[model samples]
Target: MTVAALAEVADVSAVEDRHVRLAGVTRVFGRPGTPKSVHALGPIDLDLRRGEFFSVVGPSGCGKSTLLDVLAGLSKPTEGTAEFEGRPIDGVPAGVGVVFQEDASFPWLTVADNVAFGLRRAGVDAAEIARRVDYAVGFMGLKAFAGAYPAQLSGGMRQRVCIARTLVMQPRLILLDEPFGALDQQTRLLMGDELLRLWRETSATVLLITHALDEAAMLSDRVGVMSARPGVFIDVVETGWEVERDSRIVSHHRFGDITGRLWEKLRTESLKHLRDG
Candidate 1:
């Protein structure tokens, strides 16, 4: 076959793997071109493949959350399009779950209750809700605390509860926005191990937004770094790590090199954010 044919075949294969696509997307907080309008994101093209972990890293106020919102169908782009599984995203696309940075757990609900909330709301059978909640609680290591309320748990545990809540939905695509941002560095690393395990077991596509370059390097298959507000991807660094790898791989000889690449791109954008702010 000719080289052009080979390239076309490769491109076709890539197209088949995509689970989400953002084309020429741009988001503005207010009216377009108005003095008060904040052009937050886009003209950015992004693609996420089935069962891959993709992380977005950018300086503060660079609209990292805005990008995720577009994917979640919570916010419409001022220009361009956002699609999931080959269709335009329309109001929280089916089989998609999101875990935000804030502690979203309800203090009034027990761990088991919180995990089962979504299932119940969807009118799932009581038995099915119990079964799925059981698995999610165990998977998140919250089985022992199943009866405890959010206020009684540690910050990390509460985050795990939030994750479990999302997990019980059996979502095919998981959007995580700094889910462990409130935890200590050590706790964050340990939580990354849990996330890795969850991804391995579920085979769900993951898109994480994080400020910690090391955390992005530790968890993602590829990391995209964005510029300051009016954010656009400045670089995307592929980790080439195996899907089964965990946070322990942070000590691997190549880990530093991978993080170095992310920092190199992120550093300039971060400085720009500070200056603009």
Candidate 2:
């Protein structure tokens, strides 16, 4: 499968009305006597517009990942709701794509087969699957290594494969949890550019969770800062970069300013965490 083929399967307009809405969401953990049960998340209220790029950042242990888990339906909030459209999110919502920090491409499956996995699970017709898979593979520029197994690919390529697989699913909302966190600085920058290209081509609402303030600022329309344990959003700073979805946008003047602001905000919250600890 190639990326172009996958892109062909997607209807950009399909994402126009989709959004993720979290209202009064909360989560808690632990027993009655152990230090204080971890609240983990929430009491959050937010609206993620369609085709928009949004990010959440915080200190180590601020429940940023937990928030993603709740959205993915891998974990339930102790209170409130995480909704798609207007309904509560139960399990992985339909048309929702997920790319985790780890490279999840199957070790044994070739790149094409890997990208084809989700569509197959959905019982898509074979021809349709091939088209989508091909599109995804091409979109990620994996043509030369499409036949290679995960172990044969570089880490950056593996992540690209992961992104291809998710895109092939034609998801309306894509959830990325520090997808480039493990990469070296150079590779991370490349992946960010690739991600921006994919987002522009697919037009899906994306919610990315990352610890890197600059990364969040570089890719999102807004970055949500979460407080320490019993995590909840303390502030959301809008980044006006969505209008210029080009990879080169990172080098723009406003980029540094926005990223700096996000950094200060997250750093301040992290200090509060250290104090609380």
Candidate 3:
């Protein structure tokens, strides 16, 4: 699977309107008798458009990860509703994929085998799995190491394997919870570029969570900032969707201005949390 070939398979240019809607979503954390029962999320009302790249950023303990779980249907809300394609999300929605912060590539499987595993579980036939696996491996440029086990790959390569596995499922909605946070700076950037390219090619509805403001701005169609602990949306900044940037966004003249604005919003919310604590 060459880059051009994989691009063809993953291309989602024809996908029509597919959006997720969440209304008054909330989650609580703590044991029954605990003194520290806490609200991890809103009452959050939000909408993610089809083929959009959205990112959520906030201070530590701000429940950014919690939001991702709710979307993934890994955790149900204590209140409100989450919906896909206009239907209430009662459980893990079909055609949804996730990439975690931790390495999730199967340790025992070869890179190609790991990528194929998810497709197999989804009941895709063997021929289709082989075609899709090769396409994913080629798309992510993992062809050289397709036979390598997870233990034999570097951190970044293993992460690509994780991504390839997710892609083979041909999901329409993808959630990434700091998928590149575990890598070193350079590798993270490379992976980020790869991810952006892949997203553009797939046109998947992506919701990425990151602590890095610059990363969020560079990759997202909109960036949502949340208040610390007991999370709520403090501000959301929209960058035009369907635009492509090959240059470094941070080095641009307006970069500092946008980043500073996000910083202050986060800082103000964080201060409130500290005072409450």
Task: Score candidate 2 by lDDT.
Answer: 0.84
- List, residue by residue over 105-216, the lDDT tens digit for candidate 2: 8998998899998888889999999888888899899988888999998889999999999999888889999999989887887788888888888988899999877788
* Model 3 error, position 186 (Å): 1.7
Give residue 156's error in model 2 in angstroms.
Answer: 0.9
Worst 10 contiguous positions by lDDT, candidate 1: 268-277
Encode model 1's per-residue lDDT on 1-277: one tens digit a residue. Answer: 9999999999988887999999999999889888999899988999899999999999999899999999999998999989898899989898999999999998989999999999998999999999999999999999999999999999999999999999999999999999989999999999999999999999999999998888999999999999988899989999999878888888997899989988888888888878877
Instruction: Find the 10 residues in a row with the least total lDDT in model 3.
Output: 9-18
Clashes of each: 1, 17, 0
Work out how many backbone clashes candidate 2 has: 17
Q: Candidate 2 has what TM-score? A: 0.89
Reference-based TM-score of each model: 0.95, 0.89, 0.89
Q: What is candidate 2's CA lDDT for residue 19?
A: 78
Best by lDDT: 1
Task: Highest TM-score: give the candidate number.
Answer: 1
